[model samples]
Target: MRNLLMKVSYDGTDYNGFQTQPGGHTIQDYLEEAIRRLSGEQLKITASGRTDAGVHARAQVFNFYTASPIPVERWCMALNTWLPEDIVVSDAMEVPMEFHSRHAAKRKTYRFTINANQYPDLFNRRYQIHHHGKLDIAAMRQGLSHLIGTHDFTTFASRKSTKPSHVRTIFDAWIEKDTSTCRPGTRDQGIIHTFISGNGFLQHMVRIIMGTLIEVGEGKRQPDDMKVILEAQNRAAAGPTAMGKGLMLWEVDYDIASQEKHND
Candidate 1:
């Protein structure tokens, strides 16, 4: 058997999530079905990680072992032909048999987008959270500053997550204004983008971080409070978890050298 790696992108608005559930209306479900049809063999694919429902991905990586002799370069086209338009395999390549998708990933970068427009944006209702206010970008940056470097992130993770180790290193964190454009008539002045790159993330960690930073931006919490929150080591000490719709699995890196390659 040969190992195959695929770079896939999907509009997660319609599907449940990246992983397959009972109803199978997920990105993975459709992707596996297409591969099954092509190779006539049931394949279990491994993804870099699981994204919550309504969370989109720009460069999600996955891998599977197959005995079929289909050319690696053509797999992207073949998969896209059978998969839904929202879910497409952008590229495919053959890899060493021992390579596993999730374990091999060295870093993950997640982005949380907020639409600070006071007016309702019907066009972007599905993907972005509309927080009506002028957020303090400098305050938010100060709050995020404490999160960089190695530390236990239990305060930012979901209480339901039972991972033994909550210690993770955040290589970088930054905020950008109006980093993306919406459809015509969509408000242009109030877009806030928060990007976080780390070795690994706990469940709901990024969302919780965004929410806390937003509180700092709103003046509800001081930027220095981030240090106390991080030291608390409990979920309740942090701010509320942000909505999943505003979050996206922007990129995954398999090696250290590739982590900052897509900073643009």
Candidate 2:
């Protein structure tokens, strides 16, 4: 058997989540079904991690052991034929037997999008959070600075998380304002995107961070409060968790030496 790694992009608006759950339609279920239909081999696939329901991904990484002799490049085409239109295998390659998707990831970047327009947007509701008020970008930036270094992120993670450790390093964190470019038919004219890159993330970490930033932008919380929140390590001390639809797994990295085409 050979272990294969592949990058996949998916619109998670309809799926339950990335992992397989009873009585739910999930991303893994579809991918495994596609693989089975293509090669007739029952296999278990592993992802970099699970994305919450309604969370989208530009490049989610996954791996599986397969005995099929098909060329790695051809796997994308063959899988796409059986997979739904929302989920597509963008790239594929063979890897050593010791390679594992979740453990091999060196870095990950997640983006949270917010619509700052006052008008109600029915089209972009599934992709971004609609905020009708002006946000203080300066305050948001100030708050982001506190999150740029390595710290215990227990306060930012969901309480339901079973992860053993809350310590994680944040390599980069920033907000981009007034970006007009987006997927066709889903683009809101005015958008603000918060990008966070790190060695790893705990459950709902990005969403919780976004929530705290929003509070700072709204003048409800001071920028300096971020330090206090991180120190408190209490989930209640942090702001409300942001919606999952607004979050996206923007990038994934395995080999830091040679970066992929996607940029943060």
Candidate 3:
């Protein structure tokens, strides 16, 4: 069986989530259906991770094993023809059989956006959370800085997660103010973008952290509270979960050196 790695981008507003489950349509279900149609094989694709409902992805990665003779380069165009407009297969390549998507992922980066405007930006409303309250970006940056480094992130993870460990290493975290070049009336006063990159994330970890940072930006929590929350290791000590619409799987990083060695 030849293993193929593919990058997919999707607008997750209509789907339940990336994973297939009862009673809801999903990204995986559509991909599987398209695969079965093209190759007439009932095969499963393994994703780097799952995004929650309404959470979009720019470069989500996945891998699948297939015996079909279709060239790897054609996979992207082939799959895109079958997928909905909101979902697109961007790239594809053959990989070593042992290269599992989730296990081989080196890091993943997520971006959460907040529309800090009294009047929302009509064009980007679906992709960002509208927050009327004035946000202190400086304070938010301070709070986000504390998230860098290794820590037990139980306070930020969802209780629904079945993972045994909440200890993850955060490589980087930062905030940025978006300066929109849209038409005069279409753009909002400001857009706050929060980015976090980590070795791995727990369920709802990015959203929860974004929520806590928003609280800090609102002056509801001190910037130093981030350290306290991390030490607490209790979910109750953190802020509420942010809306999934504002979170997107921005990118996934892989160890190319390791994969190349294996291929060699």
Best by TM-score: 3
Model 2 vs truth, CA RMSD: 4.8
Per-residue lDDT of model 3, residues 1-28, tens digit only: 7999999999998999999899659999
Q: What residue runs in model 1 are displaced by over 4 Å at the alpha carbon?
A: 179-189, 256-264
The better candidate by lDDT, 2 or 3, is 3
Q: State the lDDT at 261 in candidate 3.
A: 90
Give one digit per residue, the lDDT tens place, for model 2 in 146-244.
988889999999999898999999999888887554334543346888999999999999999999899999999999999999999999999999999
Candidate 3: segments with Cα more than 4 A from true spot: 181-189
Candidate structures ordered by TM-score, highest first:
3, 2, 1
Q: How does each model score on TM-score?
A: 0.91, 0.92, 0.95
Q: Give per-residue CA lDDT, model 1, range 1-264, as digits (tens).
A: 888889998889888899989977999999999999999979889999988788888899999999999988889998899998888799887766677889988888998888887664688777778887767889899989999999999999998998899999999999888734544675445678899999889988999998888899899999999999999998999999998889888889876234334332
Specify the highest-lDDT model's number.
3
Considering summed lDDT, which 10 consecutive residues are worst modelled in model 1?
255-264
Q: Model 1's lDDT to the true fold?
A: 0.87
Ranked by lDDT, the better of candidates 1 and 3 is: 3
How far in Å is the alpha carbon of 244 misplaced in model 3? 0.2
